[model samples]
Target chain A: MKIAIVGAGALGLYYGAMLQRAGNDVRFLLRRDYQAIRKDGLSVTSPNGDFHLQAVQCALDPAELGPVDLVLVGLKTFANHRLIELVAPLMQDDTCVLTLQNGLGNEELLAKTFGAERVLGGIAFLCSNRGEPGTVHHMGQGRIRLGELSGGFSERATALARMFNQAQVPCEAVDDLRRARWEKLVWNIPFNGLSALTGKNVTELLRHEPSRREIIAIMGEVIAAGNAQDLNTPIEAEIFIEKMISATETMDGYRPSMMIDRLEGHPLELEAIYGVPLTRATACGVEMVRVRMLHALLELGERN
Target chain B: MKIAIVGAGALGLYYGAMLQRAGNDVRFLLRRDYQAIRKDGLSVTSPNGDFHLQAVQCALDPAELGPVDLVLVGLKTFANHRLIELVAPLMQDDTCVLTLQNGLGNEELLAKTFGAERVLGGIAFLCSNRGEPGTVHHMGQGRIRLGELSGGFSERATALARMFNQAQVPCEAVDDLRRARWEKLVWNIPFNGLSALTGKNVTELLRHEPSRREIIAIMGEVIAAGNAQDLNTPIEAEIFIEKMISATETMDGYRPSMMIDRLEGHPLELEAIYGVPLTRATACGVEMVRVRMLHALLELGERN
Candidate 1:
């Protein structure tokens, strides 16, 4: 399969290097670093190991690229729609697009832009940050699971999963990606908002009792909302919260991306991560007082 | 009557200078600049004008100053109980002490130390910060109202008011100072926490709609807690929230003291401004989810 990786950040770089190594024609679509990566190749350093690869096509213009079988979207959620518009010309009739962005609603966006049949849902569980333009530091787990939004075990989805699994990137093809997305949403909504608001690392925030309780309350609200929407994500508030607390206990001090945005004075994922889930739940008439408070704090903190 | 001014910050300095100019014997219990003030005199600068007097007595040693008639305490709330044992020597059998500290529960701490009869609740309605050791910057309205916590209209309280009035420092005697303290508590509990949590100035915070709404909600909780205590505060939740919103509109660009403490990494009045009120309200069975949230966020910010 000829795969074109669009919106190259840490996740894009990680998959680009892996899929290229697995004997597929993988190209990176980026504007700024095309010349540099074309000259020097891509570098991915992970705790699993380090891989330096050459023979990867890098281009600045999406239209210049030939028709590709799969195009992986790995931009920030805020940039997803614009990038989709930019890369629409590169997709042929059979070309499929996959979005592995954080937070909710990106899949719906991709489905709206492209046909629902061509868009795939993904939950990429990786602790990665940009080491440089061509280098990605996969600090921890780098596993991804892909599924069709319409709950079909299609041949295309299985082939994509087999490709990823053969590349040693653990990939699971699930019947329902909505459950996967909401499960990940439960984790991101609390930890991301807590770390962003308190300016603390994951471990420190979980240790603070009130912060811990508030995050748990927020998760409860999220779970209730998810249940109301009939997603039935299968995790209770206490169980999910305890899972996060236990996970953060071993983390070697990681600041959430939202915190990084706030410290750097960049626009945060305010309306998306903390806002959308609650607003959706409110449509179902679920009370999201805790989530609303977090939204209010984020709004206040972002004021100049 | 002789008076000893505890806490040589801006308000204490202003009060000491005014009392001395009123022909009452006044001595300042201060820190490093005692000798400097004793030699070069004390200076009070205001919009009205600047004035300096050489006859003001300043002492670093509490033993050096004999029995005094009144003690004016105007330190920050964090510094309240810290030097309690050190400042005991300046008080005589009949000496009355007044506390003009910000936030709630200051009077309880003072009463615990100096007995309720000797403790008077004080509120300084002036805009001031530390200009220098011997010099104070007094701006805008300059008035202080203080009275017994027990509703006793004592002669000593009357005498202190007269002395203050004679010194051109507008002074009034209230029947109950606890209510006045709660009124001030409403301001500090919400504004101070919001300022510290967001690290923004008053105008920047209150100008935004979401922030302003959350702030009013938090203040409503504070007012509810106050009314639950039956403290005679009389500030309804709606009126109290409206007043707080109006304050941001009227006062142009002010950063609350909690912001100052966070910027300097000083010990915040987290326990007093947030935790104490919440604890009190919870004990009285008042619902204060916002207060509890503020307390959590402030504590988390403090730890970070």
Candidate 2:
């Protein structure tokens, strides 16, 4: 399989390395880390193990890479506007574009750029960070969930999952991608938003009673919003709340990506994560008051 | 008129100074600042004027002062629990207890202690700060609105208003104190909660588009909650929104008391300002979602 990973951040590098190790030709499209990665490959330090690729292919421009079998987009959703032009040069007739970014509207943006048939919605359940140029630290779980944007089983999604599983990445193909996004949001909206607003990490947020209650309330809002969209979001509020609380309790106080973005004074992925769902819920006449409040707080914090 | 100022923080000292200047016998009941004020007197630097009371009466114990005509309780609602015993020493049958604290339930707490007949609900439209021990800075408006707790006009409320007006502190007697509380909350819930949550002052919060929208939405929720409690919170949402925006636009980047309390690591008056209204709204089946979210955030922030 031939694959090109765009936006070579921690996610791109981590998964690109895994696919490349499985004998797939994985090329990284980079901007800032292009020079370093081109000179001395990519380095990944993981809890699972440490590995360094010495002869990895890297590209500064999308045109440099000819038509690939799959294009995995790991770019921030804020930069999605440039996707139509940037991704045009890397497509074949059957080329699949999968986005593994946080928040909503990424797959739709891709489908609008490419055709809906060639776009796959993907989510990464991983805790990874780039320590420096060309170096990624894989802290915890690394699983990939991919599905069709229009729902149901797809041969391409199944093949992609099988390929990921062969590489020890633990991939699964679900029937409903939109519901999957909302399921992820049940955890993201409260944990990510509160983490940014209060400057606390996952463990600290779950440990305190007030924040824990807030997390539950915000999660309930998200689930309600999802149900309003007719997405059948699967997990109940209490179940998901307990799941997240117990899952985070074992980690060593990991700071979420949004919290790191806030601490470093960078713009957050507010629109995709918060704005889209809120708008969808409101349009359906469902009031997601808690999520809207969190969205406003994060929006204000980002501007400052 | 003889008066006793309980909780001699900024509001207590400022009003006490004003009433004392009008030839009333004013005594300040102090705790931590008792010795500093007793030794050097209380000083107030105001945009209107600077004044120092070099020989003002200061009492460490409420028992030091006999029953006065009026007892103004200006403590944070978090400390109102101690008022039952503390205020018992300074009240006669006709002595009025006026609370100038922000948020709901202060008058109710006072009424629980000194009966409904002797408790008056007062709202101070002022921005003043205590910079240090025995010193207060009056930055902006100092007008006050006072009314009876049980609603309707009363001779005691009218007399108090007249006395305040004579002291150069503009005062108005309102027909409904509960309605006035709801009116003030239309401003307080949003500004105080957002200010504390986002760590921004009034001007900065009103300046940002997202925070500004949030302020309007939260104010709407508060007004709705007020109406649910049968208080008929007079003003409409849009009018109050525009009113607050215009008013905050002209201010000098002033931080509200809640924000200052958060910065100084003191417990917020969350129960009175946020919790009580939220509970009342919930009990009445009014979904005050935005206010509940803010309450949760402030509660979490206070813990951290």
Candidate 3:
């Protein structure tokens, strides 16, 4: 299978490297450093250890890549819109585009750009970041959950999972991907926005009574909003907050991606993580003032 | 008239010097740095001009001062409770202690500590900070509105106003001091908290629509809580937000005192500004989840 990794940041590199080691032809579509990587090598340092793979094909322009079986989209939510447009050259009639980006409404955005059948829901559960141009550093566990947007498990989805599993990456196929996405969204919108705004880490945010109360309140809002939209994913606000708190306690100093964006003065995913959900909730006539306020602050932070 | 300036940081020094220039014997109960000024002199830079008063008496202990006609308590809200005990020696049977601290509940706390008759409700319009131990810098208007906690224009309150006017610090005696205090409380609680939590200047906070809206929401919550307590100071949320936006338009890069405290790692007025108001709202059965959340994050930030 010929696979091209779009927006080849850490997740894309991880997928591309694993797929390549599993006897699939993998190419990385990246920034200017893509060509340099093709000339030098692709590097990955993980918990399993470090290694360099020199045979990985890399390209800055999607036109330079050959016809591919799968194209994994790994751009930030802010970049996913335009990136889907730019990576159109690599998508054939059967070429599947799987989005592993965080936030809500990303899949819909991709489905609008590409056909619904070609867009799959992918969730990467790992702590990784870009080290340098072609190098990716894994901060913790590396596992991915992939499923078709159309609901049923297709042969292609399982084939992709099997290939990923063969390459020393954990991959699982879930019956309903939307539920997983919303469950993650429930955590991301509140925790990310609160932490980024306050500049506090997880334990500090969740351990304090007021902070914990807010997390539960915000999660309740998100869960209610999701259920209101008729999504069957049920989340007890306390349970969700505790899970996030546990995850954060394990990674104490780990700044969420939003915090990193705040420090680097980069545009944040305010629209996807904060804005869209609240907008939907308001349109649905749900009182979501807290999340709405945080969203507005984040939008201002991003704009300024 | 003899006057003692308790906790003589910025406002204390400003009022003390003005009183001294009015031919009153003024003494400062100061910290170690100002204690050194007991041997030196007091210098102040104000909007009108800069001057040094050589005869200004300074004391390291409040007990060292003689019975004063008036005592101006000008410490930050964080130190108000503890500092109340120290200022007792400076007061005689007829002496009044006027509190000009920021945030809500300080006057009430003062009344609880030193009898309501002695505690005046004071709202200062000046922006002054300690330039050094013995030097205070005044910016903008150095005016105050003060009256007895009973909300009457008593002879004592009238005398204090006359003295303040003679001392060159503009002063007013309001018929309803509680309303005035609550009005200022409405402004102080939300803006100060927002600025401190976001590390944003007043203009930056108000100019941004999201922050602007969140601020208005928090202020509305405070006003609701105040009204529930029978303080009939009415404020339209939208109108108040616009007023704040316009007021902050001219003042750029000005950090709120709370923000300064947080940055300098000083003990914050979290209880005075946030905890008290939140507690009030809770008692009134008015929801203030957002304000409580911000306070919780601040508590965490304080710990950090």
Candidate 4:
């Protein structure tokens, strides 16, 4: 399959490299890493295995990349303002757009612009960062769950999942994309928001008794809100919270992507993550009090 | 009456200066301002009036200050570990201690150390900060409500209130000290915690709709917890919240002491303001969820 990767941040670069190594044609639409990768190839330093793709396809503009079988979007949600302009050039009649972006609204935006039939949304559980120009570091997990934007599993999604699994990237196709999205937020809303707001990583937050309790309470609010959204399976609050907390225990000293953005003076992806979800949950008659409080605080912190 | 001021921060210095100006013999136990105050005087710049106490009494040690008729404590609660030792020498069988501290535990601790009958708890609604060495800037608001820690009105408390009023500091003798303290927290728990965590002041927090809603919610939690504490009268959430918000609106860009402490890298008075109150609320079977959340975030922010 010929895949065009848009917004080639660490996420885009790592996944694109993985797919390319599995005998799939991958073209990356790049900006910062364009010159370096075009000159010396793309380097991926992963715990799984490090690889260098010498003479990999690198495009400065999506127009240069043109049409492809799939357009994999790893764009930072804060830059969604420029998403359509950058992505329009890569769309063809039969081409599908799969956005593995963090939080809500990404798939909806893509679907509205390029038709719902051609949009698939997924959430990535990858711990990765960009190294020196042309290099990507995959610290850990890279599992992905994707489904049609209209909801429910599809043959195309299955095929896509199989392709990713074959390429050494764990992938699954889900019947209800919304449920998967909410599940991802169960971890994102608390860990990302608190870590970014407090400048404390996962371990430090959990280590503090007060913060750990707040994290758990926020998780309960999220679960309640999500369960109210007509989810196929209501998240069991106690079990899910413990699972998320225990999983985070192993990620000691690990800061979420939101934390990095805050520390690096980048705009937080607030609207998609907090705003849209809060709105959605409220529409379902569930008030995510703690989540709303965290959102308000994060917004205030970003104000000046 | 001979009075000794312990923990001469902005609060101690300004109030101590007022009492001394009103013809009471006020001696300040000092650290940072000892030399400047002892050599020159204590300067207070207030909106109502500016005054300087020439040849004011300032002591570097409680032993030097000696036993007094009244011991006024405005100590930062984070330094409570040294409190017992510092205030020990300034005590006599007849000397009574009035703690005009920000939060809950001061009176209890003092009572436990010195006798329940010798302790009176009060909450100050003061807007002041220390300026250059001997100068204390009294920006606005200096109202104090005090009562016996044992609850109900007493002749001593009434006389103390009269003394403060005679010194030009607006004063009230409340029958229920716990009620007044909790009512003050209706403002403090939200404004202080949010401002300290987000680096936004009162005006900025109120102007933002989300944070404003959050502020109101936390106030509601505080009032509920307070009402459950067997107080004289239950706080009407709507009236009290609006009243607090309107009053804060006048303060404009005021940053609470907690915010300043966070910015200056000083230890926060978290124990008196958040810790003791939270414990008390939980004991009353009232879970102050939002207050707890804010406290946790603030604690986490101060972790580093």
> Which candidate has the highest lDDT of all?
4
lDDT of 2 by residue, B1-304 (tens): 7799998888998999999988999998988778888889888899888998888887888888858888998888898778777788998878988989888888898888679988898999988988788898999899999999889989889989999999999999999888888888888888888888888998888878877887888888887888777763456767777887788788768888888888888888888888888888888898877787678668867654
What residue pairs clash in candidate 2, if any at all? none
Binned by DockQ into CAPRI classes (incorrect, acceptable, medium, high), candidate 2 is medium
Q: Which stretches of candidate 4 lie over 4 Å from their true place?
A: none
Measure candidate 4: CA RMSD: 1.6
lDDT of each: 0.78, 0.85, 0.77, 0.92
- The DockQ figures for the candidates are 0.66, 0.62, 0.59, 0.84
C-alpha-based local distance difference test score of model 4: 0.92
Q: In angstroms, how far off is B22's CA in candidate 2?
A: 1.2
Summarize candidate 4's per-residue lDDT along A1-304 as a digit string, tens digits.
7899998999999999999999999999999998999899999998988999997897887889978889999999999999899889988889999999999999989888899999999999999999999999999999999999898879999999999999999999998999999999999999999989999999999999989988898888898999998988888989989999899999979999999999999899899899999999999999988899999989988887
iRMSD in angstroms, per model: 1.4, 1.7, 1.7, 0.9
Off by over 4 Å in 3: A32-36, A150-155, A236-239, B32-40, B150-153, B232-245, B250-253
Task: Output the lDDT of residue A204, model 4.
Answer: 94
Could you estimate the TM-score for every candidate?
A: 0.93, 0.92, 0.92, 0.97
Q: Is the docking of candidate 1 incorrect, acceptable, medium or high quality?
A: medium
Poorest 10 consecutive residues of model 1 chain A by lDDT?
A229-238
Report the C-alpha displacement of residue B44, candidate 1, in angstroms: 2.8
By DockQ rank, best first, the candidates go 4, 1, 2, 3
Fnat, model by model in order, equals 0.72, 0.81, 0.66, 0.91
TM-score of chain A taken by itself, candidate 4: 0.98
> What digit string (tens of lDDT, one per residue) describes model 4 on residues B1-304?
9999998999999999999999999999999998898789989999988999888887787998878899999889888888888888988889999999888888889888899999998889899999999999999888999999999999999999999999999999999998999999898888898889888999999999989999999999999999999888889999999999999999979999999999999888787789888999999999988888888888877777
Instruction: For residues B42-113, write the lDDT of model 3, one tens digit per residue.
Output: 888877999888766776778888688877888877786576677778778888788887766777877786
lDDT per residue, candidate 3, A1-304, as tens digits? 7888887767788777767866888888878567668677888898888878888787767888956888888887788558766668888888888888887677788788787888788788877888877788877877888888877678878987888889888988876777677677777877788888878766677777777778778888887777666554555666776776677677766677888778778778877777677777777778776788778667766655
